[model samples]
Target chain A: MMRGLAVASTLIVVLIALALFMRSKPILALKPLTTLLFSTAWHPSRGEFGFLAFIAGTLWVTLVASFIAIPVCILASIYLSEYADKRLREWIGPFIDILAGIPSVVYGMWGVLVIVPLVKNIIAPLFGGYSAGYSVLAGGLVLAVMISPVIIHISVEVLRTVPSDLKQASLALGATKWETIKFVVMKRAMPGMIAASVLGLSRAFGETIAVMMVVGNVARIPRTVFDPAYPLPALIANNYGEMLSIPLYDSGLLFAALLLLLVVIYFNVVSKMILSGSKWSLYYNG
Target chain B: MDKKNNIHVRRLEENIFKSLMVFSTGAIVLALALILWTVIRKGLPHLSLGMLTQAPKSGYYLGKDGGILNAILGSLYLTGGAALLAILVSLPVVLYLNVYLKKGSPLAYIARFSFDILWGIPSIVYGAFGFTIMLLFGVKSSLLGGMIAVTFLIFPIMSRSMDEVVRMVPGELMDASYALGATKLETAFKVVVRQALPGISTAVLISFGRGIGDAASLIFTAGFTDSLPTSLLAPAATLPLAIFFQFGTPMPEVQGRAYASALTLTLIILVISVAARLLTRKFTKHVV
Candidate 1:
């Protein structure tokens, strides 16, 4: 078992580092890294370096998308885990799981043909926006729908794990269902919920194909949700082939990938803090 | 008396809200059903036997000339290959975590951290990683690279789920087996796995479902080849890739083909999901 654990842990990090290092060597040559990562000029074929535009675009969509999804997922999870009947829980649980498994490419396809049109013609007008099919609003909205299931699944499971005795005692004292859930159940499950939400947030942040198809793949400052923008993932995939024209361009793209990778790893570490039941003790110590 | 009547009114309203909430619990099902219906409505008309046999040549893409023969075969190979690779990589890690790591050991903590990190990384990032790793060995975009990327993507999920099966092995059973002079490995392999077979099987099925639906990460790693793959290193296209590439074309016939492919992909994913749920329910009943 010790040997196995050693192999597992050591291998993952090595694989991760090797995987990044082999692709354009961002750490080995840090001299140009600053200019590559921060410059807003994104002309790849000409060897110019910049990722500020992609970084801004990615954060913009993620913020808008998370804003739309987080509240709804929290409420829905509470309803299913604490309040729903066995029959309702039976179908809803698996349905959400299955929804999460749907490929990002499928969502992209739906976005191009269906969601793009809907946003362009219907949602845009309501929000006082333009009707460009592939715009920031379309991308963020699709991402929210794509990732909402992850948020719901993880949050609901954590809520369900709250102690039954606590819930029963509250109810036995004549506390109403909503009151019991609002105060007692939520408090007990708070840490786990935060962990699960962090997990969801990371999952949403890392999602690639779904957002790429709809994000309009243009390199620019995202001043408007209606404006077209390019994210790191989309930029990597879309321009990597075209970037073959210049090695520095390829290297710049690698740095962008590294940035995205670090962001994901950061979320992973945060998720662990939530998962190992560490925060409860850390709080008391602090 | 007026206060009492107002309280009564409020109680009635709460009851109505509670009942409504209970029924709204089916909202997920309704939402999925609606989405599926919309996709099918738009997608099914584009599907036919032609999609499985003939290859699209140009703008018209009509008649028997509109099949994703390469994609159909390529998707199966990549999906099947990736699923197999993930199951193999995860099984050992999960087994170790379940069997050897003490409940409070730092090794166990690190093991979990590894799984969390592996799961957290996005598919696109994995694709980029896979490309770089393979590129060093002089491998180009190919089915092998795609499979490797997806393996990384799904390995953590299956490992986590499989560990649940491991943790389910009754501690008493392990103790009893050890008390009989069995080695820990023998006991874990022989007894624990046997007892947790059903759960492990469910994990495999879930991983397969996830593997089939994966698309974005595979795109750059697995360049779409219209011909059936002759070697693992050869570029190949899956259904999702076909849908992505073909959908962008202005041709109605090609677009229809893309929709048809989507229909096929959805049906496959939905079937595995429902099957997994039913199988899990059966396992619970048997356990009781």
Candidate 2:
């Protein structure tokens, strides 16, 4: 019975991929892959269905979020694992969990109330630009905050796996604390940190409701961070309900879902490979 | 003099980097505080007992009479059903990984990798997949469909967390059970399950919190309704979607209700987190 259940468990991913592909075959058959992927037009009423703008928007937001999140998370995790005492680390644990636990809709609401205005009136203007507050910057800011906990939690675990004796050896060789961390601990933990960041990127890439709320869903390529953009997840979420009315519109949205699934799977598989191939897993599993 | 100057420069760099790290951590904590404060300050005025008890009345979206009792109950029902379904699948899968499979079994490793990948798949994709299944089966967007979608979303979360705890169960304990003439199945059910109970409960609660708070997976699976669902086939309202719809309205009053809804969701999640922590602490005394 257990063996049967385990086999069934492994089949779910295959089934989901197959199901999505079958459902989206109509649109795939209608248009060449390049036109569907590279064309800029998205007028479903007129039978146009290009996904380039949404893809670009997804990449842009994920990139902006990575810029904001990666440094802060790495620093914070380093501090927690290296500098903070046990009591402080224990206290911070629940805080990170709470941050992760807060519903995405709540984050969206907060973004609308606070971050949007700050970007509109203060940060954007300081840079000699104007924004309505609902822009790629707003979406990226919210997403950065949303994915921080994931990166921090994983990176901290990775840092902790770097044996203390290695650090001691560096210090015993007359290295300063910062130098030991930079040369020894970070060198040891690099693969794990990369894995953590990749995981965070995947999480940010497929976020839907929060980004949808703040991202002022325009389907054009954004020229600047302050411009509105539409992302793949948001596109699927906003249009799936109404797509049944148009020809192959439902297929188009399902195709978007399929694309998201494939990308996320690639990221996860790569991170898994990194984690398993590194010496960190040997230390971690042992 | 040259050695002293070098030491001074190194000290300055260390201090600067340390301060930056501290500031980054502080900024994250401050963002959390600001999010909670914004929700409370805006939602507290509009939150009332009626909002928890009564359904929305006519013109409710226009800032009129009534509350969001339907959504609260609907969220509770949907999460409860999904949690039950997920636990059924997750527990068996987790047990098989820890108890049935060999330590270095390739199948176990593949199963875990798949779960991790599934966990990373966005809720919106699950929503779309659920919609596809519904189309194939001629099932409309209803409570049953929502439960099915959420089950898929949380299965990996529940299974993987439970696996973490169960894998920690010592081999010596299982050996003891076998030496006493117990079968592997008996040992698993009686010994390993008892040891991992605390972690299993925490996993269930955490996944429950996630299912309750998610909006993307339910947007297409559970069609929104003003009234409470009367059957498994009936449409249901959820707190996250309620907040989404209300906040999208043009009126400030409706927008205020959205804040209140957000506050309600946040509080529920907070309670679940605290409960998980406390339960883990309380139940850990029995473990060796």
Q: Using TM-score as the measure, which candidate wins?
A: 2
Off by over 4 Å in 2: A277-286, B1-5
Instruction: List per-prediction Cα lDDT, in the order shown.
Output: 0.73, 0.89
C-alpha lDDT of residue B18 in model 1: 64
Model 2, range B105-171, lDDT digits (tens) per residue? Answer: 9999889888888889999999999999998999899999999999999888888888888988999
Candidate 1 docks at the CAPRI level of acceptable
Worst 10-residue lDDT window, candidate 2 chain B = B1-10
Residues B1-288 of candidate 1: C-alpha lDDT, one tens digit per residue: 686347566567657656655544455455456567767998878777867786554533442375887887888888889888887767666767777777877776666667667767887777777777776778888999888888877777777777777877778888899999998788878887788777777777777777777776786688887677778988987888887777777777677777788888888777877777677678766651
DockQ of the two-chain complex in candidate 2: 0.60
CAPRI classification of candidate 2: medium
Q: What value does DockQ give for candidate 1?
A: 0.37
Ten-residue region with minimum lDDT total, candidate 2 chain A: A277-286
Count of backbone collisions within predicted model 1? 1
Per-residue accuracy of model 1 over A1-286 as CA lDDT, tens digit each: 5465447653775577666755657433754756766779866656566778988888888877777667667777888887777897887776677776666777777677667888778987888978687888778777777777877777776776688999999989876777687679889877777776676667767677778888788899778888887888888877756766765666666666778888878876876677665332110000
Q: DockQ each candidate and list the results.
A: 0.37, 0.60
